[model samples]
Target: MACGALLASACAGMPDSGDVEAVKASNAGDSQVRVYAVAPRDNADPEEIVDGFLEAMTSDDPGFATARKYLTKRAAQSWKPEQSITVLTNAPHRGQADRPGDPDNEGRTFPLTGRRIAQVDVRHAYRPEVPSAFDTGIHVVQQPVGDGKTKEWRIDSLPPGLVLGEADFLRNYRAVNKYYFASDENWVVADPVYIRQRQDPVTRMDPVTQTVKALLEGPTKWLGPAVDSRFPSGTELARDVRSLAPDDQSKLRIPLNGKADRVSGVVCKGMAAQLLFTLGDLTSVRVEQVEILGSGGTSLCLLTKGQAEQEYSPVREPGRGENPYFVDDRQRLMTLEAGGRQPDKPAGVPGPFGKGTVQLGPVAVNRTEDRAAAVLDNGHELRVGSLTSDEELPEAVVTSVAPRLEDRLSAPSWDGRGDLWVADRNPVKPRLWLVPGGQGERVEVGTPWLRDGTRIESLRVSADGVRIALLVTRDDRTTLQIGRVGRGVVDGHEEITVKDLQDAAPRLESVTAVSWAGPSRLVVVGTEAGGVQQVRYVQTDGSTSATSVLPGLNGVTSVAAPYADQSAPVVADSGNDGVVRLVPGANWQPVAKGGRVPVYPG
Candidate 1:
């Protein structure tokens, strides 16, 4: 089919013979700009064939049938566009191959080159890498037509998967969170993956169905070791089901194969919770309840949103209406209502730290808002104390010997599991420590990736405890990275490690601060190469959209976001303004003078 058949609006202004003018269109920074691919024309040359094929891969065409039209019969049959995807910083540049083709001159080769930035594996997991070179060759040969007289140039040998620019990838695909139970915990952990923005051609499934399929396929490799799927092995959707839609009552009915037919009601409820959470990102559809059916067409179990929330709650959802906390100029801990137009004056908590007895540098309040952990006395010592009573500061739980305050211990963070995490940036011996339940003996978490002058500048543990966000610095450049938190027993001893580190804000040249804003989203403070500092939100998968950038602020030193409520204002410590916040639909407003390290309960 021609481009007009797919998108009449895009092709409506095209010319038949005269020169064409390029006109720019904007989506106002929210919606995606759709691109319809044009099929190969008759008597096209090698360059045209390759260009058309690349463009076709970026379209929403069902089955990618048009892209195959540019390839030879054998190549088309062997090509696997679904295998993987290579994302480039920009469109690939096509040129002559460095080496000549075969001596018989049966084919010509063209090099498709670009600066590779990331790759998506067969499981639809996006892995961002340091900028690197990407070079591949497409071979075209002259083939006879049906009558065996006219010769036409067609691609005979090419790369197996698709190659797309970053812009095109964002337009054609979307990042979604698939849910799985945390190992040994009932709460669901978000494992992010990329899926087609529209229907998946290969499976003939809509976005909702595609998410269900990914969930059943299991978690991504990085998170697989830390989470578990409730679905039994070999469990899958019914063979005949292609798409999923919610009925009038906003209840979705799912049909599973026989592998799930024998599951108990409790296990089935767990499966339903996973499905409901996995399908939460499909904003276009409303699903309040989920019903699971056996392959024999019998209802196995049904779960409503309320029941799921009561039985298997999400890790980061803390209900709502939590207050924000910060350290005032007097070196005291204070609090103010979040999402308030004119909240009451910040009030000091009932503790020695709030009484200005012990100076506090950076502080983190526990999820219950009853206790606080802080780097005390010039960032050399860490302490945890209650917030409801004026208690004396306890002995330091963790201390750093780094001579300079800047090289001492970082701010402490609390996970949903009630564990405390902090990074010691000592030049001689740097380490990441986890104090179980905030009072147990501290254990040094293993991080084999920090080496050769590379050190962690700051860190934040996700509320789920399955992931940690780190601001790592090397040779004066700081980058934001997200690593998986793996816990297990080894040699009759408990072991905790952070592994599979990948860039979470690859576009930023340096990151100063970061905090988990939601289950799979974060608010970051950083600057692009040669650009001014800006605050933005980025997903755990390292994906950022145009709307991710927040309103402008000057001299931002640190940023904090509430994990439970995204509607609440984003608080930050500014160099010019002591403390500031960005409220919904408003610009930055002053919250406190000389307030530093504002934070919300993790």
Candidate 2:
């Protein structure tokens, strides 16, 4: 069968391509882009054939037809790449085994093995399960022709999927979050999307340019309808964009086509926000300002990341409408003033959770610090009430959920819009719940990333409501994963779901907690392979920095970072050393003794 015939056979009875709406965006321009792969040569050994095949897989070729050249005609036709793609964490190992082949006995059988990063299914969903499950074998055959003196080793048998080393994979694959507005315009969600670029991400200007290109191409097919963009339809960068760019000052100049020529200033800034948030995420580029240009390279407006945050008003700001609050050992909910580091006395504490019989389970304050949600009876029931200073207490309990002690609710997190989000750790009924601010409507949001048997230990929605941090425990290992939130109309109603889930802290074996330290940084408390507990600062893309995670935070039970920027890290000592905080270039300062689980408003 022909190559097209083989692929056609796979999708034989599926919906029409136009109606299916599953077209994938291509990364190639008119010029071919090669990603460091040499063509195969005659008389190649089985190992060389295998190495060449793996290298060809890294090419940005559509359907990897170039990679199949190393395989025998029969094997290439039989290969079904749509089955699955195993992303390797390291380079694959190649070895030969005794088998019948050439006179030298070196062109017959081979095996490949590696530690995988993830497995992406046919529908493009990423699965981060047992990464060491792949160990494949390949058989090679020599194509007899002309004189038998020249032997050519071609793969006769191999398994599905592509394998690449960590370095190459990092160079080829880049993650960018496409910005979309929540049902409430006040909030914008970042939908994480991975795109391939012909040029390396380390190259100057390429990272930002390619990222902005991907953003303009629009969200992936699966997530398109769930989000919206400010960039007009068919918007693209002008052919000659560099002439307008200010490379010295790390400025990005994007000249869109005519589709977005006359967009309002608000729309242009929102477009800039999307680009700034997306490009600023690149490990290689530091985007200070984005200049939105129109046709003919005419400048429309200029915006900075800080200005974007203000104009969009997406992220929740700490100390804006929030006051300090904590639960004491006596089950009292204490409040602290703006400058005071310690809470008030138990007698001076406020709220019903302090006076009621509910034992004061894990508590979370709203974005405004005027409402509190607490779990009761070891996580069976949850209730919400007003936190106003002079308001009348609820006559009785306000709202409650299914009561079961075996499964509990993780700490609740509130978004900037005053909506509360909580996860039920119930294995039988595991779910994430969202309670709208005023109406108090509880809705169950679907999170496919929350695989079965995986328990969500902690969940925190970013102040901007675009990203979420989760501590998931599975198979006795805890890891931190972040996903972009996508909200849109579904079944004629507003629905929010988490998409593009990726592990943010893959090196950590046991993660106890996670908190957003900055717009793109996460402060995590976890342990490495040796089981030595420590705190780490990591980016949303899993990259680490020296100053991201503060030092001297060991034996820290709970950790908290301000929503805006790095301040003194407030920590709860694990060994009763008292609640201490670390200041850069200084010593640890004690905040309050015996405090755990420090948190900001949202």
Candidate 3:
């Protein structure tokens, strides 16, 4: 059946049921086209030099050599490019102060300041370390040139890291996943980040070295503690080599610095998997085997493509997702096992979910299939319960303490590590939190970019646990954004934060529901124009195709496709019909007609 049902209620507002505010139809396409940063000239002034150097930092120029032109030879070599980054919204203003109490002024401090929004350290970490009253200071040295006819002003010292506007940042950097294993050492989760990729595709510049370097730079702030890596500290490629291009045999010999030498055999095996997965992430870098080379070009280990699976693997598509499950007309959680056409309602274990007057909205089943999280009492509260109703819904792990409409929580999601992730939109206590499965202690995660006047409408954590899809509404416009989840440490305690929040479908006007459809793709619903409800495919990096629409299914209140399938079966919460699954190039098979949210195993 070509299921066609459209209502303003279908793809708008919070999940479950509630009084929903209507939003205008809008279109969010794929990407915002950006140009490469222009290189700076040699004879610019201190102010221009500073600005140009900062701008050049966004460029994927080899080694940032172009940016080095703005500094003195000594400063250029001493400046640590990765020490920290100051996120700014505008151009920095230069102010100079002469030496205090000096009748004859010898030197001055060049102070540059702007509206610094956020700061990140080299570890790709954040912790309010960048002060609100932050400013970069540069020491100006007025010295004589060759003939001393003309004075040359060179920067002696400057603040660490780079600074750039949000616009330039979006244009210049692209977010890619660095793979890591879940806490239980079961599956790999991605650590997503905005790293600069070489823009000039025509040059055929290999990103392997760069990607490996960023991977070596370590996981971002929010993901550090949750995951582990085999790559040792101070890990770097030999100074003589920058890129890890493969040879004719499709083998890459990654020469590591001394830091990785003299390692145990078991550690070598783990390190091999790390290099394989890390380098394999780059779109341009293709290799069949990765050989770990120690100092003096000693062969430490080699990992073939096939061997990588045994040691460790990615969480992208673990081949573990199950058939669609949803609440039936009897208010019970039922799995749809194909029988004839509709489905057989095989009740999971224990009592039926959403029985009687107990209403349930969206339900998230962890990848392990042992438990599921759901919203109850008409969005007034959230509970993590056993899928088979084996245990009473987990004691309202999250709820609307504020009793405000905006304070309502979204359905919970489970990462590969089996952690429960939920969001609270209460403007007073807007937060993203994690509940370790079966555990009560609530660990609050931070979202630094969540500005005022914008509230989270819907959220889904990635299977990997490193990325999240958020439906945010601001000024009546609902947009789909993707955020990188990470972790940091302070005073021996762990802190979690999300970084590099970017629009995944910026051209779409309204996005009702979003679900991970592949490793780097999302199935998004909403209209490009005319309130024409349709399911569209979108990339996590904010790239969408104008014609990438799944036309048949309309007015889908909810939808689910395997995160690894670009053209996976379409599981839809069809209006008034409950739940249905439309396999690719196949007919619609009814699962249940009274279910609202249809989901695949997490």
Q: Please name the candidate that would achieve the greatest lDDT relative to the true structure.
A: 1
Candidate 1, residues 144-253, lDDT tens digits: the string is: 87798987888899876888778778866888899899898988888889998878867778888889999999998888999999999999999978889999999999
Q: Which residue runs does candidate 1 get wrong by more than 4 Å?
A: 1-34, 96-104, 314-317, 339-341
TM-score of each: 0.93, 0.68, 0.60
Q: Higher lDDT: candidate 1 or 2?
A: 1
> How good is model 3 by TM-score?
0.60
Candidate 2: worst-modelled 10 consecutive residues by lDDT: 5-14
Compose the digit string of candidate 2's lDDT tens values, residues 401-478: 436554667778887777788888877667888878823667777788677688788888887676688888788788
* Model 1: colliding residue pairs: none
Model 1, TM vs. native: 0.93
Clashes of each: 0, 0, 20
Error of 2 at 408 (Å): 5.4
Clashing residue pairs in candidate 2 are none
